[model samples]
Target: METQAAETVERVQPHLAESLPVPVRVGKGVRRLALRVALVVEAAGGGVAAHIADLVRELRVRGGVEIHLVIPVGVRFDGVIIGDDVLAQCDTVHRLPMLRAVGRADTIAFARLFRCLHKISPDIVHSHSSKAGALARLCFGPWKQVYTPHAVYTLNPYLSRGQRRFYGLVEGVLGRFRSDRIIAVSVDEAEHLQRVLRIPAARIETIFNGVKKQPLLTAAEARSALGLPHDAVVIGFVGRLDFQKGVDRLVRVAQNILDRGLGNVIFAVMGPGDFTVASGVSADATPNNVRVLGALSQARTYFSAFDIFSLPSRYEGFPYVLLEAMAANVPIVSTRVSGAAELITAEHVGVVVPNEDDVTIFADTIAVLAQEPLTRERMSRNCERAIESFSATTMIERTVNLYNRLLKEHR
Candidate 1:
């Protein structure tokens, strides 16, 4: 991997802007023919990857820009992934070693990565999520950097107020001093970043995340794939079974629904994470009423099996799962978080219950949706309509336009 990565990196001619590590500025009679963009991430398989995947596809098609994709593999950090299909869009791929956001090892590893990036000298450096966002800013902030904390850790509901405040302090210091631009995935998230990070409002740009528009699976087809009976009222959920996702809360709600003999409702939770005990059985151990399927590789297609989609996340940025549910035309029931998912209520495509520990409200909401076929149909259609605003094409166009505007300002 080292030898191959070295060869790939060697292919690029460092065409740095007058700003040194920043992209070259077109001055006088010079016409800038191409811009160099580097997208760095520590995300493996999740919404971050989905966002990067869609953005990379759109970027390559737009042309006039050379993209160098850096993904840190062979380590535990959640970062970018470059599958063969995703590689087709990138001009170069760098697979370096990455450590999770702790310990001195992270400093050592990313220091090496910083040198590699220095060699490439990207004009535009965009970092995704928490770890990469911080590392990239430290490495390239003096040049040109865009940091997108797909979801800020400080805003996670699982964290105590003090812990959240500490994280907010760290992020606040970094955002104000390091980032050239901060891309907020949702409007609510943008406001929170400004409030917590004290980042200038001008530095933040809210580009609600987007998903690919694919033909959705039929209810019968999705049910067949999941081996569900025709009478089952399926409530589908896709996300990590982590503290952030609040799968424990979801399990308790499922148990309550089952105990009440609420129609033939089946809870299908899909995604990977550490397990926790709920009622009697472990959520990862597979409870009776809840079918906890480990992470599905093609989850993007499985959203259609549900009568309603649910997310009980403790906190979130803009979740791609929400976008997938909309594209699949499934109504949503989610806990209110500071992220863009709150738009569900504004758009009338889904129900948003206030964040609380009790499962009674979530169970009752699910029961209500199960009983009202007309309401479900109306919300589902609204979800389909909502997909247009968050399409892949729209996100790409906005992002590229941002790139152009940023270039002009720096130039």
Candidate 2:
């Protein structure tokens, strides 16, 4: 792996902005220098992993950018898996211990990460998610730093006043001095950064994460593979079975539907992480109508089987799963979380419940979709057209452009 990675690094060309529509500016003329980028991430799963993978793949194709990955050692939580192809594209790979919570172990991880960054000495250090974002900022070096908070912790409505203040202070301090640029995946998230965290408007950039439009299994085929009955209406969910994702709320919504005896609907939940533990609803007690299908590779392939795709997240920075649902032409029934409202219109794409945790409203929204097949079909048609704007090409181009602008200023 080491030799292969070195060979990959050796093949990097010296045409950083050659493929980009606009070239990087250095003084008066265009400067063509190979930009070395080191990506630091701790929550290397779900949307975070998917974003990094897409970004790395696009950067590799564009050429002239030496990419390095700094990730934690061990498997990801929530059955989240990063493809091997993402790692193969990198010039070097560094694995160190990184805990989700701030702990004594972080001191050791910090030292190791500092050494790794010192060795790479990348032109830009791009950190994904909160943990990596916080760590990369504190270990200040000559490299310019860009932090993508996937979703800020302080956005959690359930957070206590004291907890909100504490996390806000940390984010403010980091955003003010440590980070060169803060990338928010949604405009709603950018507003939260300015309003809640009090980060300067100049420091934040809104970049909607994009997804590739891929062929997926047909409804019949997808249902057959998943052992779901074609006769039943499936309200499918794809995400980590955790508090942030509101997996427990999803379970409750499913129960509410069952209790009300609304249609022949069954909820199909798929993702990594223990459903019983995360949802606080034991496996034995799980309703027969709710099928916990653990996790699957390329889960989006089965989105066709879903009559309605549900996102019950309490907070999010533009979820990639919603993008996948849109790509699949699956009508969404999402809670009005950070990016949910932006992605989903109340009746155009799918219903967006105003309340995040209200089980009745959520269940009612799902029931409405199930009962009105024409509404679902119309929304599905809308999804086909709406998804085109959120293309992978546009996203990749914008990111590279951001890198170019940041590097030009650094020079």
Candidate 3:
């Protein structure tokens, strides 16, 4: 069956190749209206970088904006590069020697940022992640600025009550000065901004993250490269190993699966984080059944090897990994936090357990899916259908429209 699946994917690869460079057309007038824009992001990695890179590429190719990217100096990560192909569309790339520091360093960063903003005189300044958003807004003065939190700092369960409240207060205060609009990656996140952070519902907009679906590689080829049997049931997790990712819970879930003696199952984690940082650390860590492939440059290769995908994040603004997994037509299992629940439906997609649920529930859900081949196939098909709503073109068009509207209103 696995061999046949591989053959099917291989046969379809040529059709996928023929569809290269998904066409995007922008009206000449709208292109002409494209304002001078600056995008700010903190240290790059993971989904945030991918999202920004995709938007930049699409904007440069389809829109008329004179785009400038302001990124931290000395930071390198997979998919961080905008590439010459995309860079050709941009007006400039500016590197700031701003360290990802707190206190005095942040003050210095703000100073530098203010100077840069003064020099660039951008029509719009869009910021991503916490540090960049805060600093960008602080330095904006009277300039139009927009922020996307990616997942607000206040959402982390690891923080103390005081810390959460302090962060929330800071965001509320900053909300008054720096933000013209708050872009929430999910509807759930938008609601939180309105209820908890007191951002006006009118000012908040939900824009779902978009992913480009790569041509499917054969499952046999994928498994063989990863050195797994053709018949193995593969469950894959992709994300950073930090506390927010809920990797500790994932381990417990994997252990439960092993304890239940499931046959020929393979578990793989693809991302970076120290195992020691995770709670519930044990001497008997990383059992034989589990493989930790830390931080692959291209997840599509590993994604192809999976029969199912899971993301047990404690909170998220919106996870691009989940979108990528869905695009790959893999069944999903994730916590009902952030946008994960909203993205997956019980009828069409995989299970969404409560955030605090024990690993047993997650493991048992995987067990059921593994045992039922027909159910897995149905879920996979549904994932393919769900992905239609989240193409890169949709994200670019909506974002560009927002940019134009905001620029017009300000003008």
Candidate 4:
């Protein structure tokens, strides 16, 4: 029997690599059995989607791993339907009706998924996010199951204590009885699962999310792209609008930063939210000093224009946005959300605040970073030094190795 050699993968000319799919390697003479991976993800946008996209890219080129994407039927990423361009490289795509967040616990749907996976008989079923994590653990048949929680639902400050306890109970049951293995995106997240869910230390591993590096655009060019005034000091944020991201608090604190009258300091936001005029946090919440991009496919490309990249997330897993900032050598100010502390440990890299909801504190931190040019330059240098630690290539290689290990164990 013969198989394709992924090492001979035809490259997508450097310029077209981002939007277009690179051609997969397959030919008449092409002797390796691809490890079959059935990857399930309910949320098809934001950081987790970026992670999936990167994994898909590397797996297609690296060979020896046949990927089958099991994504939400009606979900979209970058404001477009998950189309054939996304499907262009995958071995298969399963668009099943599944909801993200809320831990979508519908047994009927789970049974249908189980039957589907049973037929495909993937070597391993790797699920992302809390909702998919809950469903994948139950969809177990012959496949080894691997779950990654972008953020643990039980530890989210936005949820009520009672709700947190319920989630904790559910996670405990899943870990004790159903889960095969778990992979946390950060060391903090891995530790939390071990401590809170009592998942054994050996059962979980931390693999940091990573970003692709590119020649950074000049500040002027990046500012032009985002419509920010080049002369102004800008603080940027990129994330989907949701409870976990704490966009509401972001707007308020950004307003406070302006109130302090720090001359020429502006807040630039890339990414959309549900905050319309109908929602209490409407367009008006964006003071004159703030610019909302709604959504931009290449928003992170504008990172160089920012004096500081701020992430006021109440809770998170490993965010691709933070890695993007690191790649751009942008200084950071983030809530000590799950994976943040690990990356923002050094003062030069930026500061991580303990209080998730303390908008004043978050605001104060950003203002200083925005105003201090020498400090920002030093942090930028530090980010350049640390970029290799968050390389997308590294993330993909480790993931492929894990898939192979699971296959060997299964045999």
Candidate 5:
């Protein structure tokens, strides 16, 4: 009966190739079958959404797999919505309501997720981001569970001691009993899981998030399009204008540079949200040298407009923007976040400052980089070479290989 069912699936989905095999226990022998995967994500926007999209696109091309997607209903972040084209790649799409914080509503989210997983009957259930990773793991099931926390909440330095402890406890418990595997997008994240959360080292795998190369504008062309002074040194930022993204820090850095009378330096932020509220400064009070661009589509393509790319993130798990910045041949100025050391191989490539540094430090780093055109040019060339190692193709292939190995062991 199982063999017949597999054959039927192959016949109906000819594009699947149906050649790759996963092992399943049957009587005294093992049987080969197509691996079925269900992906669940609650916070389904930004880099998390991009990661899932890349995985689905590549998995479909590889064939021998059935893919299902589960996301919150009407899930949109800062005007960024998941496209219908990405949803079309999945065999099934399930929607549930989920909140970013722990609350009474999680009961409903968990129940709906449980029902969705039962209907899909996937061989492996993969959950992305913190919210969905926590909820999906709590539901008991025979399917092997894989989790990827884009950035664990406990990693946030601003979290209260009590809040950090509580979240860490939840993650520690889940990591031990619920998860079959936990993928860390950077070595720093994997080490944190082991050292801080006490998650076993053996259960963790580091898989860097990848990005597709895109055509970028020249500095002059991008400046013209953005309505900025062509001769000025533009420092660019691209991320959510929220605490985690350190928009306040970005504002402070910009103010510091301007206060020093760096009249030729300017700042452009490309993402959705209110800078006035985030930076605790009224619209009229904001610095004249800083421009807040709310939600520009394909923000990475405009990277060349800036002499330097600034990432003031409080924390991250291999940011897609950083990779995009490299692909765009833009030198980076980043806080010592998860993936900085791994990607920014040398001082010639970019500068990474300590995360605890004052805004002045960040401002000065950008300031100094701006003056050295030759150094920036060398950094751009190195970025072009470094980015090739983190392509979407390599990331996808490693992920599929992980799945195959896990399924084989499960039998």
Candidate 6:
């Protein structure tokens, strides 16, 4: 097995070597010419998948590039297809069966990718997420690589400090070989990458994620569907029930609200994650006036049920839920993490507080917002106004412009 693996590496080495030289720009209108680009990701899910889909759609509309999505093997995206509508706009969709394992999978994927890069000879390769970014950069040889971490790997609470440092070190080293630029979804994230990973500021660019405006459902309809009394003051949270989401904080805040005997106030947590006891919430445990809806796939439906949306995440790389909530004209109350602080203009859009702060403060803020209908309405209007800049069209244009500038400089 060792010998076979060695032989495979040897066979792929030449291909990697031959592909080291960058492709020459041939045409006078290279920018206008549809350049072949590969967008690689390890596993497609949630916000990352949404971003990829949006990027592909915009790239198609722009008409200057052909996108080929190269994803990991055995990664199934049921009911999601890059259909003829997308395919008709650009080039071919090539699916690579590259496994993701520690050593064996890495070697095999690198070998496969080395050969694929040689064959496709793409003008650019853009990678998303940690695994894909690392693997794509390692196997890229001399490809002009653009990496967007989506959310930096080091931000994960699951990693030990040493592990986080190691990952950052790896990213820094790889930055020299593979990355021409790193796109951070928020300035906070870019700063984190620079500080933790030692990636230079010059290599990092901050681009806030954008969403399309959604129509707000009537308060009556929203309240009725949520089983909330028409006159009840609704305070809502939307996101996964994961630790990083700080759902426990939200639950504790809910408990406090209920304990205070706040009249006509309902606390709802929309979205899903494991609500096991270990996660600080019981799947079966009941808290008075607390509604926990696990794993909401259709977020818009739940967004309609919220009078105010709160995100108590410990950290984030510009959450999509925030954008969606704003689009829905729901006032927000979020922790001062990532772009949330910058996005929430005090008394204009919503309130921003420190992470893991007192549950009373959180509960109090919600209670205050609940009591002041005019204030809530003002924040709601401000959120709607601020969302104009975050529209999908705006984000796509900015992203494409960046791509164009990068390609132009390199070409």
The Cα local distance difference test for each model comes to 0.76, 0.84, 0.75, 0.75, 0.82, 0.71
lDDT of 2 at 194: 96
Clashes of each: 8, 3, 0, 2, 1, 2
Candidate 1 lDDT (Cα, 0 to 1): 0.76
RMSD of each: 5.1, 4.9, 9.4, 6.2, 5.7, 7.3
Give the runs in model 3 whose Cα sits over 4 Å from its true position.
1-33, 75-89, 99-101, 279-284
Give the per-residue lDDT digits (tens) of candidate 2, residues 115-174: 789988888999998888888888878888999999888888888999888889999999
Tens-digit lDDT string for candidate 6 (209-288): 88765555577876676677776777777666677888778877777777888857777776545655414866556566
lDDT of 4 by residue, 1-411 (tens): 111221112223444446433235578643334577888887778887878877787777776666778776554433242345556666666655676545444564576567668766788899887777888888758888888787777767677888878888888788767777788888878888999878887778788888788667789998897788989988888888666677777787777887898759887877766645312475655578878777776666678888888887877877778888988988888888887888888425889886556588888887887778999899999999998878889988887778778778888
| Pairs clashing within candidate 2 | 78-272, 78-273, 79-272
Q: Show pairs that collide, candidate 1.
A: 17-23, 17-24, 23-123, 42-78, 42-79, 43-78, 43-79, 43-80
TM-score for each predicted model, relative to the true structure: 0.88, 0.90, 0.87, 0.87, 0.89, 0.82
lDDT of 3 by residue, 1-411 (tens): 653232111112233333223223576533333467888777566888778778887776674576777777554333333444444445556655555555777886777777777776788899888888888988845467888899877777778988888889888777754688888898888888888888777677788899888776688887777677788899998888877888888888877888889857778877867755763565467656777776666666568889889888888888888888888988988888888877887336788877874777788788988888899899889988889898888988887778778878887
**Candidate 2 off by > 4 Å:** 1-33, 77-80
Worst 10 residues of 1 by lDDT: 15-24
Off by over 4 Å in 4: 1-32, 76-84, 101-105, 215-217, 276-280
Candidate that beats the other on TM-score, 2 or 4, i.e. the better one: 2
**Which candidate order results from sorting by lDDT in descending order?**
2, 5, 1, 3, 4, 6
lDDT of 5: 0.82
**Tens-digit lDDT track for model 1 on 1-411?**
755563234223244222122233666554443678888887645788788888777777676777787776653323333355666567677766665555686786577669767876888898887877777888853357888888877777667888777788778988898877898988878988898679899889988888877766677887788777668889887887676777778888887888888748998878767555322355355547677666666777777789899888878888888888888888989998755345688778878887888978988999899889899999988887888888899988888788888888888
* lDDT (10s digit) by residue, model 5, range 1-411: 653232112112335324423456999996644788988888888888778877877787777777888877553422233566566667766767778878998997888788778877888999998899999999788888899998877888888989998999999999988998999999999999999999999889888888878788877887888888988988999887888888888888988888888989899988877777777788887899998777777676688898899999889988888888888888999999998888875424688887864877788898899888999999999988887788888998888788888889889
